[model samples]
Target: MNKIVYTLLIFLIFNHNFYATNYYVSNNGNDNNVGTIDSPFKTIQKAADIMSSGDICYIREGIYREEVIVSTNNLTFKNYQDEKVIISGADLITNWLPSDIGSNIFEASFTGAETQFSMLFVNNKRQKMARWPNNETDEMMMPEDVKTGYEDCQVFNTRSGKNGRRVKFPNLSGFPVDHFKGGIFRGIVGKKWINPMGIIESSNDTELTVTAISDDWGTNSSKMFTDNGKGFGFIFHLNALDQPGEWFEENGKIYFMPPVGKDPNDMVISAKNRKLAFVLNNRTNIKVDGINIHAASIAMKNTNNCEITNGSVQYLWPFFTRKGYAVSKTEQGGIFIDGNENLFKNMYIAHSWGHGIFIDGGRKNKIENCFIDNIGWIAQFTSSIQNFGDGTIVTKSTLGSSGRFHIRTNNKIDITYNDLYDCMKMGQDAGSIQSTNGGNWGVPLDLKGAEIAYNRIHDCNTLTDGNKEFVLALYLEGCFNYTVHHNLIYNFKTDVVPDGTFVYLGPRMATIKDCYYYNNTVWNVDWGLRVWNRENRGDVENILFWNNIIDGKANDGETSDNDRNVNSLLAKLSFKTNIRNITGNGNALFVDANQGDFRLQTNSVAIDGGTEVSGITDGFNGNAPDVGAIEYGSSFPDVGSNIDPEDISFELISDSSTLSTNSSDLKKESIVVYPNPSNSLIKITNLSNNYIEKISWKLTNLNGRELFTGKALTIDISSLPVGVYFLTVNKTKTFKVIKN
Candidate 1:
């Protein structure tokens, strides 16, 4: 007995470091089993190779195409209870057939050869890749000039009865035109935000040379004109695969159509060759719940206190070649958090070609009550949440059709109380809440303590094509101390470029100074608080556009010289010259600018009017502080209001309910609405005396469309259409009515 075998090997290594087990993965288990819960274990990287830092893996339900790389830290990958895991990266084609020249097409044969499928799926939806004015009225234009420098070559003509890029039309139409060389051509350049994509290199039928692999027709090659021929097209091969859920591939052969009644050998295709499907590198106190993260790309590199709640990252496509025209493309979409106190709650990131959450650098990160939609159409910095991080927080979220709201060079960030609407849609001059502050690794960083409060930013810039495409709902450029308060920016549409805006600050070359725009509220805008700068960059300083209520137009001077303000409004611009100590006192007088309420009624005239500026209106009500940003009696700040300050304290607070109140502190006698812009009767009283018997209403217009819902006290907008409408009462107070 060699001393009883050295005390039995130190008691089996202290019982394997004091037990902490619970690992069971499946997909018909078998990685040699033994991961308990009834012998499970079959990939999840073999239960992350025997998990350790406070282990706890469950995974059960089916489909686990795999690609998880985690380094390990308080790991806890859940999903054993309500089952339905699904962590795919694609791969399940099921030998298809029938295809010798269409009948509704159908084929599928790939030898793998290193995998390169652009994405396809059947029994789980998602297909459409083959494009080209395929219905929605076949849209197509652009007849003249589009011949680019030849530095890499590019040429596009079309328009003139179409059927050119190889022609076939009449009925379901055609376009195999000899597979048009190499294929790609996406169109819509010159700052309509972005659509760039050219590749063919040569093709007859109506011009289409293409070859410019890089810039693709953006970065402002003089706005790269195509005029306004709208969203031109042409994606994969197989003659743009004539309609019906489209699909196409070439070489490795794929071609599809099915959707008319489905059949392709009883569905279930799936084809996203994996770019990512889970790879939390640096690792930390991890916790990923609910799970449904399909088709890859979900990184969190230098990760810290990680946490991704509820979960859902559908069809995430990550593989960008050049979606930028001005800058912002490190390749992100469907989660790409760099690291720090992370927490992405109630998540739901959809369709992505780029950006639905891409935070570089990182500090106190937090993207709450999340829900990011369609997201960036090909690029232009793309965003549903793009924070350069410092003390980040994007709250009560609901972002729509993305691409605008980039926010570079960070400091103390907190973009609060959300409900951001439609958005830039595809890139133009930009702004659905865009921010910039010089730079860093490249030098320039300027912005400090920031806070864009109480949001409700409405139907935003839909690619306004005035000076050739520009839009803003709140686009701040340059730098400095901040506090742009109590927002409720309304319906912004100028159609063919009347030049949109509801707040556009300047310093394009970079350098905006100290700020404080109090009590904000702007309506159907075409321009309402613009501050330009252009030549040599750096003249807009010490600003303070106080107590606000601008019914569009408050511009502080200076136009032309690459900053154009053509055919102007706000009644022929006149807020003084080259601008300096900016100051616009106590504003109010937008009493029902025809239903789009900028709140201040009560015989209006902007109530107390305003002129108090001490720590910026240190809580004023009557005879003094009432020009704008809401103080006709208070109730509109949002989320524990105090004009927002939980720790980015730039200091100073005399407390008028934390500067112009409104975090559900409702007053001004609760709720009441009368003729207030009526052309056909309107009335909605509820003075909070509490007798309330079913409120709920909605009357949207200005392109948010709802036209009218029920549960009213009196409603009848004489068969609608007078422009500018929105009533939303019970969905949580929204008023501004005037059918006149």
Candidate 2:
């Protein structure tokens, strides 16, 4: 009885643990226990710490100021009730206090030397003042001495009819009121000194104001100043605008203004410590989902099998620096997967300081259904950044940079069904989706058994002027057994001055087969397909170009230039011969000047055409073969009745010997079968072939997998499926059958 009870208890516990344990996180909670409905953990990192496999951590709506890192495997972090869970930086509060009286010291300099000057104050105790020179010359002059000098300066008064009065200085240039009293002069603004006078309501001095009448003083009253001296005092000194000052309140809101000579600090945070927001070192089978990760110097580094899905990562721009200044210090990428076999899906990563999704060293990794844009903005490659402008999507580093994809070493990597646009200025290293260099150690060396398919690559050469070595689509080098099929490449050349051509297959052992190059329209392009072999490796053999449609002409006029269409295809071959069935309406192939050892037979249809003999296939319409992409063939019929209709039905008829035996008994003497291809099973009611042994039948596909087998001739084949199949009889010849 006790054993039975213990077994029941164990089963209950196992069933209970199989279901996901739901944990809730809210900002209002203070406890760390994720067990209760009311009390929950305050931080995502705290919740992630205790989460086990098959656990769901539901976070509530609120701004979280902490960084959450999930190294747990198969754990899901989702929003509980609200999706707008803002994970932001820690807010630092800054308090400000007003400056006390006589605490600030102001001075003036003219041409790197201290000067003493005066101004006219018409509203002072003495309207007319005399100018004075300082008895002592000091680097830091007193405000009272500067004010006394300004009070003694000459002034010209002009009465405005009967309402107001105006005053002006006699001399306009020399000693132009270089010192001021009880006032702060701001930074210079367009050849004029900007000063801040004391609160006008508190001062007992007559409220005499001065105004200028020219268009020079039009709408720039905040920065411009006039020398009309009257009750209005002209105070001049070094401006306090550039200096760092405290935040002040005017109505009820606070405003921060810097003092003179003080520039705004644009460096918000320096990530020189190589601090990463999230680091995955030698980890596996970890999943990070639905988190906003931003503002780290390096967002993520050295992760493997780490799936990051349904999230966004963006780097914040520097606050007050000029454009392109602090680009190097910004965050590196949304996710940097260096290890092998990682999967990233449905992630929106953009506006990073570096590559959006950088998979440096990985094998068999898959990145699909993700939106990656606006990357490669690092300051190290300024020209490349400028070529990308503001619309860079993604980049593989390849400017003699140490960070390379290293695809040559690792195989079985698939990059498909993702929108990659607007990333120009430089091509990738070897084995990338597209590369620039075509030498032996060049681009194609990395592509061993790689598959490039089903992508829309257009408008690639938008920035063509700077780097003339740009290969728009792909540069094939040293690659072997790779496939480039079913991709839409159009409108690649956007610049007038052509930099580099498109699709160059270098001196490499590779195969280009079964690729549908239909509607691959190009304008102003130098060459459609350029293949060369300067490396003399002798391994550049068996490169096939089957079933491809080459439509446009080469921009170069020469029939056999490297930039010419057919010449580009022939430059890579060693012993060229007549291609089989290369059909097209336009000029398809061009042989190079050095291609003399190559020969085309009299029956060879590609005598004048440029296609190689190995590229052509036997499945063409012409007597021999046509030149380029278009194949001339007989018009296909409606594809009706490959077999006669009499072959559709099957029946079993009794022989004359069976009927002659007995009409009622119908002694099974002989049986005859007709109509080989039938929709249903055949009937074997009258078995008259007495000498025949047991009947055995088998149905198979072309590769010979017996789908259905039976001993009885009247087999119930209602379950036998439809397709072209073969039926074999053990007693007689095998018959080809079709089930419809």
Candidate 3:
């Protein structure tokens, strides 16, 4: 049992034992001595109230603004050794007076346990929350406009005046018309992915008018605008709290403006009353190691093999209410995983407003080696890991969400090797790793042995949701089959998400759904792959691109004279009919991939040139597999956390260690289509005539969808499935069969 609880936690830390199961916790101690370690206990919920089930507490150092309810289980809190500990949730603010400052505006007062707030930290940073086109600097959360890349997604050309609940805005002329009277707009209306904030019921300069305060704002056609669709500010309002760290609140006072000019009595502020800093309620194998956990979060209810290791879960409590409608569940702010097999390891999670780790369910949960960043700054489609569950196992985590949204799931997931980046921020048709095919949410997709291998997904940029068949990097829509390999999906912080961005291979129904996309590597990314079929429902005939290294470079968007490949996304979205199942070719060169280092340099053209596939290139280093997600003189596998690990298991990589034996590239591909009877159908034969008219083929299974593609040297695999399958060539060989 974990080596008998680490040998009784090494005999209660080298013999300081008395069998009360070690407790302590301090700021110099005293919740009534006797909690040992020279009698500590000044509230870590008073040693989580008389510790029990495998007890271990230990805390120590300082800063602990309460809220810790652990219905005990196999416990073990930790910290003592590092002596850093912290668990605050704001709540300091002592005295400000100078008649409550001004212009440098400052003031305080609010003790009814402080009425309400979304944030305000001062010395700990994070201030600005006023708003009204107000942003002299200190860029407070969203509203950075600057893209004359010819704006006009039509939302009425930047809102040209509305009706019912009125809107207007499309002029500026000397600003100030009661600075957005009693503010709160936060736009992006007429549904360009619902941004919603509303409630300005009155203004002038350019025109305003809103009231229904919520419920998607009582129609002006549900807050109209759609031609360049979203953009608006207004917010908070105390006459837009004029710059300098801004903040606002009225009546019972509480205003500020010190993000730097100091002396609100030499700053230390803090406001944001405790909101459950660490609950682990209904606990089980509990283990909140290494402490830290600032602005508060962490509520693993129905908790199970619990374990929140390492440290830092910073700032959290972001936007719990801006008056509702459009996104809720009290708008996330990180860490909320609900139960079973939990174990958020090596944590670091930051900012938050919308998920940094939501996964609100139970089942093999395991977001390992965490480093989650910024996060959907305002419920921006709750990516940054939201809705993950059912055997979820996002490994080696390093997820970053600059423009928001990075993961939206439907279930049975296994995302490995992680390092994901800026997802479709400002949101739209996103996909920094998004999944669906739970019949698009009516939930039911469990496509058996799934596994999106060796991750490195990159920038799914956004200039207002970068519309171009919607930005990319592993987007899977009607998700079929599923064993996407050795990942590396590439770049783009701009070039405005050009045509089909990257990897879309969707599949809804049309019977035969598969996916085993091979030895991956995709750079620059602008249609490096895409095989659609959603309308007139599914059928792209086995999407293929084996031993991949798919390349893409120069592009400026708006379909710069079409033809970006993957048979031009099935002949320019004219659905199906592009017949280009691409095989490796000069391995699309990389090594510097403009500096994201996609490995494979000297004599590049993809070293060992692919075709391994046995539980994914199992331990190979040369003369064979080598495409993306690192392996050209091997290295890059620590995508985020794992310095001596082993203890995971969340199902994938089905059986016989992935079968498929024998090779010399499988004796030059059994001549072709060879799988020794068992189901049937394979072609090529005696391979000569320069390998039968310069070979080219694409089947599909191993769960990545597509059954028989072009340059067809014959294929049928009669209803397929038995184990192992692959066969590239002239893009550069790759053969590996087995089946029976």
Candidate 4:
């Protein structure tokens, strides 16, 4: 522990990369053996403890049910040679016994010392907890799955500091109310957010009382679902555990009702006792690859320059943290990077009541090509990714689910070339990509920079109470100084908030000012733009709207100026009365608006009709700036993420025609099917555009027989006869090639 000795140890540790050691951990090995590939260590931690910089741990196949924390820097942890390695936070439950609860019911004593468990996994599948509106299928919290609606409840006898708020549910409810004294109240409680869950302190047939902590809100009978509506929630008790695949915990015992009609004795039942499978506790330059993590998460706390790719994290349930939504190991399901310059790419994340990838601090972190969906299905405060920091970027990713997109905290981010769909699938009062910022509340302030461009957001149709609910693709509240351009938004628009809209800018509690909105295309929606100043006590000023196209047959002609390009659904851009500081025109013409193409056409009125901004219109194709996202004559860049599992680096094919422009003056086409005389297979290659997996390709013989079809990054025609074949991209452009 002396100064010179410690400094010398640090020097040797940092320089150990020159003679890096290769350690191994296998389920079949022992810890006493040397850390070799043959005589591997029994646990991953055994290698992690002795490893310094540049040490590699090759984890062998099989599930290791333990939490491994790596505090060493410049380390590599990966599976050994395509072996299926799983780090699980769950322990196998073998001693299942019959329970007196009912027939086919079984109970197991709590063996782990964790005191409470949130998830019960049967053969790696998560089971539903005991509650009313029983999760009938894997469909999540769909409206039909739960018929319970908000009731005329009241919140009173409110106490601060964990006593929470006491709510009374009236209307003379039936059932033994005293037996549900300790049940939980899980409800939306009038707000789209805010899942006020608490224990039932006292109850009677006339009114059941429950307590919810936090002063987020308090409600009254007439105010249920209203602004001040406090009594808008439902309750569930342990006594309601009567469905298949349902389980509950009570008195330090775990109970289960077997799923798929399988007996507990015959199924691989496990309890999630450990919270995390891997913890990168303040380590740097580490890599975790090709490992499957079940019933746990990877918590990267305060680490930098780390990477997690080619992996997955599943079966993350609620790990409730007391006193605000605190960031901790308990609030993890997918990979979480809480540091700077970290990267999580090519990861598939699903099923959690938390964020898939949470950037808990302000730094330049990123998520690339990750397919994150089916998350936040349970309640509020969930998103596919939540960036609480500035300079965060999510690119080439497909994010969909019942939850929100990125949980914005007055933060700056770049959301480009991603596919977002099915947003607000089971929740409400939110947008697919939303930011509720600039309030008197103590959230972060002035996160005023977001580059939202080139993304495709659609199919945001979710139902509640058998009626279509309103969803927003881009909803920025109390936001300022943002640039939104070239993004394609469709289908996910609702005027219920005012008059129909695809993009919404609201001056809520804080001013919506100094934002540039231009070159965007909205189709199949009511209105292309909606600016609401319901909370206009704060100013709405300096909004620049330039070269936007709003089209589609849904709004054929609500007004005269609403041409096929400017559909008069709510007069193009619906602005609240007396709140119009917006400048620039929101009208334009498209090449083929009927087919959802927003590119400008020759002789269109939009050409040279707009102003020129510095960075945006620098590479204009026409005299000035044309209308809409893509320029009329310019080559189209690919939109959305390529989430294909088989994607990799392919040698770029040389084709001069693929780089051509689309204008009449250009001689060549912008996109082309390469290698006109392919030997076995051909690739539809575009030099200018990003790699797109959903770029459809179809192969057919001259006889009109379809040889190959479906979404393709590349098609294999090596098995076909040596003849000329027709290849189509998106069924719009067709090219001929020979399979020799």
Best TM-score goes to which candidate? 4
Segments in model 3 whose C-alpha atoms lie over 4 Å from true places: 1-21, 26-39, 43-55, 58-63, 66-86, 92-204, 207-232, 240-351, 354-375, 379-404, 408-426, 432-450, 453-473, 476-482, 485-561, 564-740
How would you encode candidate 1's per-residue C-alpha lDDT over 19-69 as one tens digit per residue? 668887766567898776666777777887779877888876556777888
lDDT of each: 0.60, 0.36, 0.60, 0.63
Q: How far off is residue 227 in model 2, in Å?
A: 51
For residues 187-256, what per-residue lDDT tens digits would candidate 3 score against the true structure? 5444434555555666776666655443444443433344444454345567767667777656766777
TM-score of 2: 0.45
**lDDT for position 515 in model 1:** 70
lDDT order of candidates, top first: 4, 1, 3, 2
By TM-score, how accurate is candidate 3?
Answer: 0.34
Which pairs, if any, clash in model 4?
Answer: 219-230, 223-229, 495-499, 495-500, 562-566
TM-score of each: 0.34, 0.45, 0.34, 0.72
Candidate 3 total steric clashes: 22
Off by over 4 Å in 4: 1-16, 111-117, 144-179, 201-207, 213-236, 259-261, 319-335, 441-445, 461-470, 494-500, 508-513, 526-537, 551-611, 618-624, 633-636, 644-740
Clashes of each: 22, 27, 22, 5
Q: What are the per-residue Cα lDDT tens digits for candidate 4 across 525-566? A: 655454433322444556677766555432222111222222
